[model samples]
Target: MTMRAWVIKQYGKPEDLVLDRIPVPSLREGGAEPVDTLVKIEAVGLNFADEIAIAGRYQDRIEPPFVPGNEFAGTVVQTSGSSRFQIGDRVACQVRSGAFAEYCAVPSHRLMAIGDLPAPIAAALPVSYTTAHVALFQKANLTAGQTILIHAAAGGLGIAATQLARSAGARIIATAGSEDKRRIARENGAEHVIDYRQPDWHDEVKALAPQGVDIILDPVGGQTSERSLRLLGWRGQLLVCGFASGEIPALKANYMLVKSASVHGVYWSFDRNPEEIATIQQDLVGRCADGKISPLIQQVRPISELIEAIKDLGTRNTVGKVVLAW
Candidate 1:
């Protein structure tokens, strides 16, 4: 059988993703063979990382002629004998690749049950939500009543952090690039929103949280990284998530010595156990169902427009997550 997929034939631009009909993956499993679970993809989540991978800028190595998506949601169609998931189960998961296809052969361990949530919501949950959860709850140990500053407050990760922080009872200060994004951030439970593109953005953050923010979730790591440290209260944490600003900022150790502040780097995908991811996924699903948190979907297009959708994400013109529905 044949399936349609967005293949990365060569690393260049978003348009380099070529749609091609490829054979459906086999469910064969044995010793030394990967345990595969076949899923008919219903939705695929797009991230800034997708643009990085396509442009050959990501630190991870990617060979051409491979699929370039990280997260997906679908129904299980077939499974290898070693798998616990049965056919027809609704699920979502993040893979190293192979998600931008009509069907994906994901390993059984990475699969997370989506319960009754829609496919687009499930697809948007994995990477962004996981990153936010781990950064706030695990790394920073954010507590209720504390203040948090979320950079890029209108982007996928920023929106996730804003919602999670609000659920935790933390006072949120969200920084976006535009007024529309600021409004979106505020609607997502951010108590304070600032236009980060303005020169006096951090001034607003300072006035809002006079005691200094207890935590800062920074994905834009250029000048924002260094500036975020100034906003941190004593013993506060500046969680380093990514360098979306195209420059990685450096800090001096002496500054931390005086302020007693620490910089924690959060790499959500590293050293993660499948069981933990499953638990996080379940929690996020519950939150979504209860309306405590939501997957902010900015656009949903057909799988054939995958390239154009990716291009839109690359331009950083959209708010929240961009999804491709099959």
Candidate 2:
């Protein structure tokens, strides 16, 4: 059967995306044959990385005629060689590509069941929320009553980290670019929000947490990580999530020795240890199920507007997770 997809005809702008008919990707088990299990994508999540991909500036990643999405939520349409996902089971998955299409394939192992949450929320969780979960709880060893400073606190991972930190009983001090973003952070449980676009954003962060935060979750990188070290409490930790700011920062050794603070590099892509991810996923699922931690989705649009949505992400104009539905 034919499927509609947002094909990246060339890497440039939203206007460059070409919607076209494409073959539905086949499901494969053991790499042998097309299996019956089919994933009908219901929603796709957009991130700043998709924007970078569109402009041919996505870090070490190369250009695209490639589909730009990474995460999606879908329902099973068929099944073979996989009993775990029954027909019609609702699942969310992370993939290198293919989610922009009407249909995609998901190995039973990659599927995460989301009982009642909408596809938009499910699509938003796998990558961005997982990064936040990995950084705060797994990498930084977040514990109750700790104080944390989250850069880009209204962006995808930022909002996730804010919610996750608060759920873990960590006092949240967040940094955003504007008043609207600051309001979003506050609504998502950030105790303090600073306008990081200002030269004294870190100063404001320090003022709020005078003793300094125990952990700083920095994805902006470069100068962000460099300057954030100054606000670390005694024996605090800096969790390096990504270099979304386009600059990777190097640190002075003396800075580490002075505060006895440690820098942790958290690569969610590398945290592919399934057992560990399963455990954390379960933790997240339980909390989410109980409504203790919510999937705070802020924007939803159709896949037809996917390109425009991605461009909006590049402008950093979005708050919380931005998702596109079928």
Candidate 3:
């Protein structure tokens, strides 16, 4: 059987993505490490990292002629003999690649039951929310009454962090480039929202926090990352999520020395601790089930429009998570 997929014949631009028919993956083909489940993908969430991977700039590089996607929602159509999931189970999965297809062979460990959540929303949850949960609680240990500054505050990861921080009883100061985006940040949970495009944005943050924030969630790098250091309170932590600004920033050790600040690089994919992953998964799933947290989907397009969808995301023309429904 064949499945339609977007394949990157070569690394370049979103325009370079090719829609092609490929044989559906099977669990039986797993040489040494067998895939546990075969998921018939229903929806796929688009991330900034998807574009990076397509352009050959991501940290984990894949050779040409590969699929470029990280997170998806689907139904289990097949499973290995020892798999925990049965056929017909609704699931959301996170993978390094192969999500931009009609069917994806996934390991049981990467699969989370979707329960009653919508497929697109469930697809959006695994990556952004998982990263936010780990970054805020595991790495930073954000506490109640603490203050956190979340940059790109209207995007997927930003909004996830905001909701999670609010649930933890932390005060949120969020930054986005425009008023509309800033409004989204406020709606999500931000106590204060600032336009980071302003030259004096850091000043605005300082004005809000006064003595500086307890934690800074920085996905927007470039000067934003460097300037965030000035807003860290004593023993404050700066969680380095990703460089969505396209320019990586250099931090000064002198600033860290004065504030006794710490910088933690948060790469959720590198987290191999099964117990920790299970804990975060359970917490996020429960929150979603209770309607305490919800993913904000900016747009949902057909899988055929993947290029246009990705282009909109790359240009920052959309907010929150973007999903391609198959």
Ranking by TM-score: 3, 1, 2
Each candidate's number of clashing pairs is: 0, 1, 0
Error of 1 at 23 (Å): 1.8
Compared to the true structure, candidate 1 yields what TM-score? 0.95
How many backbone collisions does model 3 have?
Answer: 0
Tens-digit lDDT string for candidate 1 (159-249): 9999999989999988998789999999999998888888988889889987788899999998999888888888889999998888899
Q: What C-alpha lDDT does candidate 1 achieve relative to the native structure?
A: 0.87
Ranking by lDDT: 3, 1, 2
Q: 123, model 1: CA deviation in Å?
A: 0.5
lDDT of candidate 2 over 1-326, digit per residue (tens): 88888778677876787888878777666653234457899999887667666677765465567666788988988777754779888888776667788988766666688777778877887888788898887788899888999999888899889988887888888888889889989999998888888898887877788887899999889899999988898899999887878788988768789889899988765225866765666566566768776766766887878767877876776777888898
Q: How far off is residue 101 in model 1, in Å?
A: 0.6
**Candidate no. 3 TM-score:** 0.97
Worst 10 residues of 2 by lDDT: 28-37
The candidate 3 region of ten consecutive residues with least summed lDDT is 26-35
Q: Model 2 residue 120 lDDT? A: 82
Q: Show model 2 residue runs off by greater than 4 Å.
A: 9-14, 31-36, 55-64
User: What's the CA RMSD for each of the models?
Assistant: 1.6, 2.4, 1.4
Per-prediction TM-score: 0.95, 0.91, 0.97
What value of lDDT does candidate 3 attain over all alpha carbons?
0.90
Judged by lDDT relative to the true structure, which candidate is superior, 1 or 3? 3
